[model samples]
Target: MTWHVFIKELKDSIRDRKTIFLSVLLPILFNVGLLFFLENVMMNEKVEQVTVAVDSNTDPVVISWLQELKELEVELVEDPVKVVKDGDALVAFIADADFITKLEKNEIPSISVFADPTSTKGGTTQDLISNVLTIKKQEYIAQRLADNNIDPLTIEPFQINIESISEGDDMSLYMISIFAQLIIVLAVLMGGLPAANDLFAGEKERKTMEALLMTPVNRFHIIVGKWMTISALSMLSGIFSCITFIIGVNLFTERLADALQLDKNIGFFTVSLLVGIIFFALLISSIQMIISLLANNLKEAQNYISPITTLAMVPYFVLIGVSVTELNSTHFMIPFLNIYALIKQLIYGIYDVTSILLVVGSSVVFIIITFVIAYAMFMKSKWVLGKS
Candidate 1:
């Protein structure tokens, strides 16, 4: 009987274009659009040129070198410091009046840089100038060493050589892991929403609740059937969204794909991630169903239920700054945060069986507790009919 109810509800949900669009198609489009926008617009854009004010008294050779660099545009000014303070340039360069004489005498000369420390452009300009000066200093040292008949290599100590055995780009894995986990969690809430709202609240608003109750089916069986339907749709939404996101990443962004790590442990990570999503799906489904059952009508249900997606995201934001290494087995016992922690583990290819087990065990306990509350609510005639 529960199977029959499940099949009927599933068919009805599949037939609703709105439901299908909300649950599956929207997530696919969102993932693809997000990847396209990030790849072409956000990530690929480059900083072209930074302007700086240089004092007229500065050395002509230094001024010419700065002007020759493709990334800098130098402006000669009498008061470089005043130009920078007045926001005329991103940075300013000034040197002591006898700077050239000091260099000829092999004596160190003072230099001053001025810029707004809080400005991003100023910071970038400062970094560029600093790098150029560093290279010039090294050249000056080499010339002095040659003049004294000393080998440049004699000044350097032993160098350290580093070799990495890791497979993927750390930056790419970090970005993909965050994007994938967020999409999956949001998909679960969205996918189950339409069915949960329509199953109970829509029926009440349409005056069909009485007909459903008149059937000889057990109330507990009805709740189970409806819960299973929501869970199945939620799982479908999450799985399809994840698939579309991966494919979108592969097809639209070759830069990320080339750096992606594909190894033996990928199988374990994928399976564990899927299992974690499934457990979360079941938990979210029961909770949504309970919210739906309590609402007087579809509008009230929507008003009450829509905030859940935003509420679900709070944990993601909280855990964003925390590193995976800082988390212990106790962290996996948490609800929304455990999924994030699991993704962090996958990012670094760390498979902690204890954390995985705790996630599964805690999820099961929450699922049972929520389903029991939903069952209790369903058994009450007043809640079932939304009267009191």
Candidate 2:
């Protein structure tokens, strides 16, 4: 009877193509589209060149250096400050009248830089100018040391070497992991909502629950079957979300390769991640089903279930500051935080069997608790029928 109910509900769910599309496909499209847009924005930022305005009195050496830089286009202007204020360039450099004399006397010369620090292009322009000036200062110091018959290398007491022993140099992997986990969590909740509401609340509103109860089946079995149907839909949504997210990440892998370390344990990582998502789906499905059974109508059920997403998101924000290294077995024992922490661990290629077990165990316990509550509700005539 339980199997029969599950199949019936699932078949009914499949017939609602609009619900499936809204619950599953919409999230995939939104997330993947956002990913592509971010990729383009970052690529544009990387190759963007800034124009620099230089006063006529600027030294020829400085002008030549700026022109040689691939990131800068130098334009000699009568008034560099005016050009910058007029938005003709991101930044301007003006040389003092005695700049050449100061250089000959081995004294510091004044160079005025005009820019709007509030803008991104202006910030980049400032950074480029600072870097060039630093290099020139180092060169001047080396020349001065040579003229004084001193070894320039002696100015530094010790040589420093930097070695990166980690697989990746940047935090891009961490960022991607957070995004993927959030999407999966949302997918699981949203995917089952329509079916959950329709199975119980919709049936009640449509006057079908009484007929379903009339069948010679155990009330617990009937509820279990409905729970399975909702879980299946949630799992489907989560799986498709995972696939879409993975494809989006792969599309930008080469572009982000230098900043992100590719995980070599992808097979194990994927299996574990899907396991976490599946278990979470089961847990959320049971909860949503209970809510559906309690509501008098589909609209009421939706109102009750809507806050579940926000409740799920609150943990994400709360645990956002918690790093993967800081995660312990205790953290995995928690419900929502466990799956979140688990995803973070998997992204960094840490597959601790203990952590996985903790997450699974916690989810199973919650599922059983919710299942019991749902079964109890189903057995009662008042709750099932939403009576006063």
Candidate 3:
């Protein structure tokens, strides 16, 4: 019976230590342990003070004010522009001789902030210096007004209040997007590989293929049963990885919940997510099985599958290279890349029917092609009996 074959294959796969570790343990290690370690290190480390380069023409009082601020460190350099250009300083201040006198005169003076536009460090340093200068100017105005026997509030006629309408941090979508991609690649590949090799090459190598061929059951039933078994394992691996990521986020990143939108959405995955995940898992499993069936032995199968396994991670690289907004119709045709884009958009709470239909339809077409190819290869007596 097809059910019996499915059950037998599933049990055999479940008993393998390699399947257990690859499907379950490795995903946890990849998603939870690795992400936590990297993020924690970045978040907890002490930030170094911003080093600002300034020339002698800069006002001593302004320099003193900068040095007194805990966020900054003032470094005097002969040529501040050259220092900034050399990357020794994040920002450089070029001022004329009468910098303080101009401020006292309540006259605005030109002071250049030299920074590398391409560098985040340079931009951050420039912003901090600008903020400090702005506050200091306001203080100077207040003092001048008091000395002139006028009210400081005269200049500040009205105040504007800012109201924000958007919800939790945007990085939430980016984070969850990355997590889903890893789950698909790691889980589907890891869980399906051993089953694929063992079911095909291992059975052939052990001389069991001949006996299975003599059975009354149709070959279609056998292949379907085996495919189902492999697909089940693949689905489980992806689910386990997803669950591990969720738990890890809760335990390790509770502080980031507000910013990650976890506090609002709380439950990230829905029914559609599971359906999409399972659909991709089945697709990936079939590809693995096809590769496994091509080789004469387990070792050969592994050698062939290794490169594909590496290539299966193309989605992650694709995500890094392209922004979600830039993705178009053709991009949805790339095997794992489409799934990656879909999963990311799904996490961001996007549910456009066109994207869903594109991936689903493409998957159906590819699966049919691979299945027909695999079935044809499998039906050959020499190939099935390991004579080829």
Tens-place lDDT digits, model 3, residues 242-343: 677667766777434444444455444544556666778878878877887878888988999989978878767767656666778776776777778777
- Specify the poorest-scoring 10-residue window by lDDT in model 3: 254-263
lDDT of 1 by residue, 264-318 (tens): 4657867887888799899999999889988989999999986877788888887
Model 1 residue pairs with clashes: none
Show the lowest summed lDDT stretch of 10 residues, model 1: 255-264
- Candidate 2 segments exceeding 4 Å error: 27-46, 52-57, 75-100, 110-125, 153-155, 159-163, 168-175, 201-216, 244-266, 290-307, 314-323, 373-388
Model with the higher lDDT, candidate 1 or 3: 1
Q: TM-score of each candidate?
A: 0.79, 0.78, 0.71
What's the lDDT for all of these models? 0.82, 0.81, 0.76
Residue 177 in candidate 3, Cα distance off native in Å: 2.3
Residue 185 Cα positional deviation in candidate 2, in Å, after optimal superposition = 3.0
CA lDDT for candidate 1:
0.82
Q: Is candidate 1 or candidate 3 better by TM-score?
A: 1
Q: What C-alpha root-mean-square deviation, in Å, does candidate 3 show against the real structure?
A: 5.7
Per residue, candidate 2 scores C-alpha lDDT tens digits across 254-351 of 54434334456668877998999899989998888889889999899989877876887887886678777888887798888888888878777788
Whole-structure CA lDDT of model 3: 0.76
Candidate 3 Cα misplacement greater than 4 A, ranges: 42-167, 259-268, 321-333, 385-388
- Index of the highest-TM-score prediction: 1
Residue-level lDDT for 288 in candidate 1: 93
